[model samples]
Target: MTQVPFGDMKAHYQQFKSDIDTAVSRVLASGHYILGPELDKFEKDFAKFVGVNYAVGCSCGTEAIYLALAAMGVGPGDEVITVAHTAVPTINAISMTGATPVFADIDPVTYVMDVNSAESKITEKTKAFVPVHLYGQMVNMEPLMKLSLKHRIPVMEDIAQATGSLFKGAMAGTIGEYGAFSFYPSKNLGAFGDGGMVVTNSKENYELLLKLRNMGQSQRYHHDIVGINSRLDEIQAAILGAQLPYVNQWNTRRREIAKRYNEGLKGLVTTPQEASYGAHVYHLYVIQTENRDEMQKYLSDKGIQCLIHYPIPGHLQKAYTFLGYKKGDLPVTEHAANHILSLPMYPELTNEQVDHVIAAIRDYCKEKNTASVATPMSAQVAGR
Candidate 1:
């Protein structure tokens, strides 16, 4: 039996071993590990890639969001609106700011934040809107920006899963006031270890973020304001910088794999819908089926590894019970959480592996008696 892992970071390293090893060797020789030239180069290069005027390297995605919010002075007595369907780190970052994370439902088709639901969650205390680009798709930013302007609220984009995604030809992190990206080992442009970045066009925000990520040091331990120790280390910065050039190629491969999954699994499952407003980089190729748990088990038994992007919505989690959200508060989010399952996704996955996984899913659907109503790929496109 052939086994397919959800993501093979070791394989990824092996593929880029030469470059990664060289980067590590150079950084080790430099002996300047913290706040060094490598970090500066990567920040500038990443800012150029994202078409932003400034980019701040941080320890991780959660800190990226926290730094952005802190730069904007969002804290206690403030409210930040975001979706309940995203990674908990999104909410955790908001919580780190001492602000309340108000929940909003997601769009049924795109599975991203619904602008209308976000608008409804606003109040006088609403400080910012953090629209998470979940599963490599950018949210509809045009209307969201209009809403931001109308309500006088800032937009912070969570680009953890959307490193190279685009919206109306604009880069993912460039459209909002702040864009927070994660370079976790499994992302489209992942680092060898934990890393993150925050991009912005505002020089003021950029300067403040520099201070916030380094314990509020104005210059050499002269504390200016309250902050945290969240600087991106030299080694991780060098590794990410080396990987940055290949990000677009990797994203293209991910899209090609997604297209294959859509074609092969169309009728058997509800395939991901890419909104016309943006390109989906396919961070995780998710499918929706009524028997998600059973299918996951079947796939596991077949030596095909699978996982759920999220099995529980953030608002309904036990840790967030104090938020006062109940089971039915976010109907779409709650419903999708039960049905969505992520198939193995990575640029390095071969066609044979993808076909094997697809065959397993097709087999599962056929046995479950759900193939009779499988929809055509055309019919399953967005806005249907």
Candidate 2:
């Protein structure tokens, strides 16, 4: 059995070893590690890339969301609407702000927030709408933006998985009032460790975010309102700056890999879909099937690594029991949780490995179909 690894981080590291090393060394020599020049440069560069006027660096993506909410005065008795099928961090950040997370069902095909469901759920209490760009594809943003305008509510984009993605030529994060991003080693533009940023066009919100991240101090120790320590350190920033130049190239390769997967695994399983209005970075090439558990086991036994992006929807989790959601409440999200599977996806994946994965899946499906069909038909013929 040949071992095919899932995500090749080592291969990614080796691709830019010299530049990463130099970036790290430069940061080390500066002796200003936390919230230093490196962070400044990275924030500026990232802001430019995302097509936003300002970007504020923070500890992690969750903190970025929290800070954005706090900056916008989203607190107790507020309801933030988002999809049930997303990283828990999205809900956790809302919870951190002492706000309630109201979940809307995902679009059955795109696995993003269903705008109609979201609009129906909104009420006078809806302080914000967090449209997560899940799986490297933006949600249906044009209608969502119109809804936002109609309600006079703020929109914060949870763009952790979609750094380079676009919706109607506008970057994912920049479409809303605030865009939160993550660099958690596996994202399209990952850092060496935990890092995040919040982007916005409003100068007022930008200044507020800076203060909120630094213990509410406009200057040294002149504390204002209460805040937390959520600064993005210099090492991570330096590493991110080193990798930022190649992010577009990496994203292009990921799209190519996704195209191959779509072609190779077409009829046997329900592959991912790319909506006409946006581009997907293929953070994880997820496929759905009724026989998901068996397929996952077969791939594992065959020395191929695969994983479930999420096995449980946020509404159904034990932690959200107080939200009063039952199993059948979110039908689409619940169904997807049981059936979706993420295959090996990274820019470093080679064509040979992709072909191997495709062949293995086809072989498994062929045997299963053959056995099920032959036995039943043979028995029918005998009865006849």
Candidate 3:
């Protein structure tokens, strides 16, 4: 039996073979691959798409986060608030900047940083906050923005999962002081390889971020400040530029697939929520379920590919346990780690594949229930 894939990058690449090949060959022929015209054009075009004044292209999403923080002047003795349920990269980016990452629990329903919790966790050392647009759903930026306004703290948005999402007519990346986007191959607006960019409305900050990504060189080998090397490659920029025009269209297809999944799995699992003010881009189509492990195994046995977005929350990881988070400290974040199962999702996934995955899940649930019923009722109750 052939197995399906969670992310079908080859299928997506096949759709733009000619343009991608041409873009790469052009860069190879130019012999000027690093930070060339391709990158400049991509930055400008992406900034316009996000409704921002400036964009600074960087090497990767993690690098982009660090650069954005540096540009905003966050460093040692500073603290930035973020959710612990997300990827470790978000928190590590802050730690790598010589700043402490103060984490709050996510909202169980929305899987986004709970603004109320975030506020309660702020302290004197708090210099900035990152409200991640987790799993393609925009965080409630209005409240966070209001909080930032009240406290005069800067906000850098982690919009890696929400490339084209919006909250109340404002784009996801445009609401904060700086918005960092990832073009990892699995993202909705993915590049061929690793890439990320930071967008900002502040001209000075944008210039600084640009400089920070290129070893602080205001000019050739002219070191302005201590900075790290992180530049987006030219070939990736060209590929991303070619695909930029069609990002919205692909996201629309993803939305349609999300709708089908919602309808198909209504009673079987807890589907992702769409807040009244925000649009969801369906990055992974993550479904919450109590039987995630068993479901994952069943899907594998059926040759259906599934994945867990994160089996371990960032705060509980061995790398971050030194931050003083003990088990059972964050109930919501822990619950999320046990339940999130990412279904097969991509813009190019066929309708038949979607239906097959849905049916497999339904059948698996039925079989599990039947097996449990076959056991003694008293034993089953005791097990529960």
Q: Largest TM-score belongs to which candidate?
A: 1
Residue 150: error of model 2 in Å? Answer: 0.3
| Residue 246's lDDT in candidate 1 | 97
lDDT of 2 by residue, 336-373 (tens): 88888899999989888888888888888897873111
Candidate 3, residue 214: Cα displacement in angstroms equals 1.0
Candidate 2 ranges with C-alpha deviation above 4 Å: 370-384
1-384 per-residue lDDT for model 3 (tens digits): 656688888888898899899988998999989989999999999999999999988988888888899888999999999988887899889999999899887777778888888998899989999888988898888889899999999999998889999999888888899999889989888888899999999988987887799888999989998888898899999999989999899889999999998898877888777888888888879887766788888898988889887889888889887789888877777777887888988999988888888888889778776321111122222211
**Candidates sorted by TM-score, best first:** 1, 2, 3
Tens-place lDDT digits, model 1, residues 239-293: 9999999999999999999999889987778889899999999999988877678
Stretch of 10 with least lDDT, candidate 2 = 371-380
What are the root-mean-square deviations of the candidates from the true structure over C-alphas? 2.4, 5.8, 4.8
Q: Which candidate is the best by lDDT?
A: 1
Clashing pairs in 1: none
What's the count of clashing pairs in each model shown?
Answer: 0, 0, 0
Ranking 1 against 2 by lDDT, winner: 1
TM-score of 2: 0.95
Q: What TM-score against the true fold does each predicted structure earn?
A: 0.97, 0.95, 0.95
